[model samples]
Target: MAGTNLKCRECATTYELEPRYVCEQCFGPLEVAYDHSRFVDDVGALRRRIQGGPQNIWRYGDFLPLDGPPGPALRSASRVGLPAGCTPLLRADRLAERVGLGEVWVKNDAHNPTHSFKDRVVAVASQRARELGFDTLACASTGNLANAVAAQAAALGLPSYVFIPSDLEEQKILATGVYGTNLVKVRGNYDDVNRLCTELSGEREGWAFVNVNMRPYYAEGSKTLSYEIAEQLGWATPDRVVAPIASGSLFTKIAKGFEEWLELGLIEGSVPTMNGAQAVGCSPVAQAFDAGADVCRPVKPDTIAKSLAIGNPADGPYALELARRTGGAIDAVDDDEIRAGIRLLAETTGIFTETAGGVTTATLAKLAARGDIGADEKVVIVITGDGLKTLDAVRDTFESYEIEPRLEAFEAAVEQGVHV
Candidate 1:
């Protein structure tokens, strides 16, 4: 494995790469540390090797925290589960025009197997779980992770337990339940469910809670989004990245991915301006960034963007630091703006993204309206999940015309601008 050990982000303490996510000495988050000496020596060969590998994230296995080489045998076996990454990075010219930007791209992660970016994290965490001799897969999710964990576990022939807020979207609940996993819905929000899962992780043996005990490995999965963006852009980084912040993991890890590639000479460009998006109802990270606070003050979530409703974001401070260091900002949008964002992206780019993506799109628009983005800057806005997951958000947002299947009725309705 290129990943050597788990290193504390705060104290720099190291530990063996087991199912650990926090440092005992400083209680800071632990992340996978790598030794890329071999890849550094042959950048050209490394590029060739990556291009020649599988279409999924396994192509970038060298950067991921895997136990052994992602050789033919391992790749073939891993194919049994859902393969994530390599989603489209489309140039949204119309969207750019709408936002008054010069160049804009959309990293539509909703194209994944589970229709969300959580598939990428679940794939990596579940693989590491199997490597560590865990027999079951589990997670406490906002919505998308529940669906991804259940589907991946089913594909891997592993028994799984998924915990989620009882009030999650019915679409997500139905999607997850279809996979035959044990779905447990607690009577609280995402944070409450996460707390329960954390306690259960310690009590339940032979269980791999992907976002808890296995979080260090799980969080590394988000880095693949950046890897794909750079590779798809012909090995170049964009001028800015606008991605939604849930637990702040994905937002920060995307920057980490660019840093790793730049250090290894794989991609050419400085780290992009990191703009973090959030719903006004659950904008702890944005609040901290706006207030110039070192720590986030947790808030109770009350947003339609349920997928990004993490009140107390674990990586809040790190996300704030990254935004400030990169000369970017963390902005929050209200539900009305979120809904407008969803409609704007779909109309302009033809990408129907979930509420999380709405938050991102609206934030990007806010930045553009404020002239925060330069006219010639290349920006990438990440759409985390498909719009279908949050169908209610678009309900009654637009009007539908009903005709009596007659040309006269259609003509009358069209002329009157109302259904008759």
Candidate 2:
């Protein structure tokens, strides 16, 4: 499908694709409704087109909402490449050995433009911002989203305004601010900042809130991760996927990505299981899943995995659906587990993931322990952000172990098998 109409998910009523996000008829959430039959007519051609196109996520433009040939925004996207969607599908042999899995891979998105996979979604969001005639782009973020919004908007020549919690990582806060955007630090947690942003959207007219109203298309960007994973695995879907749970959007959208690829015949097999991983202190969705609830109950944040601390995730219900349909599991890990997960990943795979990735690894460990993930199953764990970004979390857990410019001390430490 070249373009799509919007259909309400709840009522099945259709609407024209406009700037509106919600259904005017039934007040239901509107989603992109593609002409699937027509879109599937040339799946091979679609694959060839994507293979021959630029390296960014827009290589699959035929699947997106673009109205014509690649526009100026798309051209710019291509030139930069951002090396966005084509991140490494690293085979974690060491990690597999530790976890006792026959096959395990890490989709390392920490290498993105702003040092997180948020760039993929935010890239599409920023492009949509320019396409929809908005001069300013904005979002409510705990950390990663803020960094992405500032960087993408700045790169795209749009004024950016990021609203973030005051208790966010100092590195993340400074990273966004250094982009020279308008960074507003709210004195509460992420949920509070999100609430404020939701209210402000009503008052702001020309501003495009990327994660709010511009979110539907913005969320579509996350599908690229799943798309890449499938393609990298030789045009077949994996057996399982474990991803960090933030607003629950990423995990749900990644599953959607694989589903769309299957529907469009981009992949030859059925979609993989989508598992959700969360930090224990901020795991509202995990609690809901554990309790067999339909929706996640909101809670106050209390986790070092600040990036995944969205207690009131918007896509929690969808996440539950994805996991249940894939026969996957969702679980949470405590702060200590998160830290150990990070260390385990770093030691085994040479990927320095923040606590969010730690959550995924820790949950993957738990899933393996519960015999949920099979030894021979092909599993992909997403590492969203770099560990160095949240130095505070693991600061005391690690130290320099400096030896005062002495070879003798280094020899002693080496003999002791110590981290020097």
Candidate 3:
């Protein structure tokens, strides 16, 4: 594990791993690099390390680029990231059969502390924010990130400042507010809030922006989803997987996870076909991928999935390439289709996922109908957040079966097979 360096993904130029994310030589992105040999002959050793470590993301610290593991004082007080990795990998047999797939898995990340996958990224970002000598945490969020930043900061006793669109769901805003963040609701959409945060980061001082400055590290947390999936599957990959894309980072990182695990000899399997879902209302990434563009064009946000409403994704270009390289596609479904997706998953899996989850499940049905998911390919669908955050999106899907609280009414309904 010695001589670890940060290497430019573009030019292969290496540098001492420091508090930097971009390449100095080629201006390309710099990513954490390691001696692959460390993982070459120690799968059992690594497995033991993970089993012995705390039940959080730290179990995969060897794969992480931490300068060194954080101290106990900081780790103990960390409110957000108490090693929040091991999400359930349900067989999803009933759901898969209903969706017409062979073998299906649901990576239910809603079990995290903050009830969303954002907790994984925020945990890493919060740790790095501390290590980088910052006392305040801030972010430009759609919904989930705002809540995660506030919750993580509160857990660590770090002051938090957050910004988001004014039109965000009441539940999300309240979630962050309850954590005592200096929350600012911008008048426009998510993109507007992001622009303001970017400007603030440039003009302001003494603040750590989770989605910006600490972003590279924050994004790395998404890779843990892949790591857990493979480990839970007994060190193998699924045939295909569907993810909900907003900034497009999640889809790309999940792919990177499989690649790194393979390179480390931690898992032996082919990479999953990584398709992504987006709302048709705001799908610049999907549009760019469909149009064969190298970059995603930013657009106005207008989707029920507020958490997945980043019109201008920082990782959109990389995401498109990942989908294409893996023989997958990024597709967008309409509001109706998205709502249907949510209902379908809830009825079949007994899991109430947010709009993004609906996007994934609905798109799974769409792809299955078009024969994108063959009858025998093993599929995994990621459910990132709890549905309670956006109840309004699916509140109308059910018909009112209201009746008087009487035995005659109940009998009438029962005679109509309503109870069944």
Top model by lDDT, which number?
A: 1
Q: Give the Å shift of residue 18 in candidate 2.
A: 2.2
Candidate 2 TM-score over all chains jointly: 0.94
Ranking by lDDT: 1, 3, 2
Clashes of each: 0, 0, 2
Weakest 10 consecutive residues, lDDT, candidate 3?
71-80
In candidate 1, stretches whose alpha carbon ends up further than 4 angstroms from where it belongs are 69-80
Instruction: Give the per-residue lDDT of model 2 (tens digit) for 115-192.
Output: 899998887766666677778889999899999988887676678899999988999988999989999999999889
Residue 178 lDDT, candidate 1, scale 0-100: 100
Tens digits of per-residue lDDT, candidate 3, 1-420, equal 222877777899987755456677887776666776756777888877766766667667776656555533454665334456788989888887887778888999989888899988888777777777878999999888888888888888889999999999999999889999999999998888887987787666778887776666778789889988998898888889899999888998999889988877778778889898999988999999889999998988788988898888878888899899999999999999989999998998899999999899988988888888888898999999989889999886886455689999988886776632
> What C-alpha lDDT do the candidate models reach, one value each?
0.94, 0.82, 0.83
Against the true structure, candidate 2 has what lDDT?
Answer: 0.82
Candidate 3 residue-wise lDDT at 54 = 62
Clashing residue pairs found in predicted model 2: none
- Per-model TM-score versus the true fold: 0.98, 0.94, 0.93
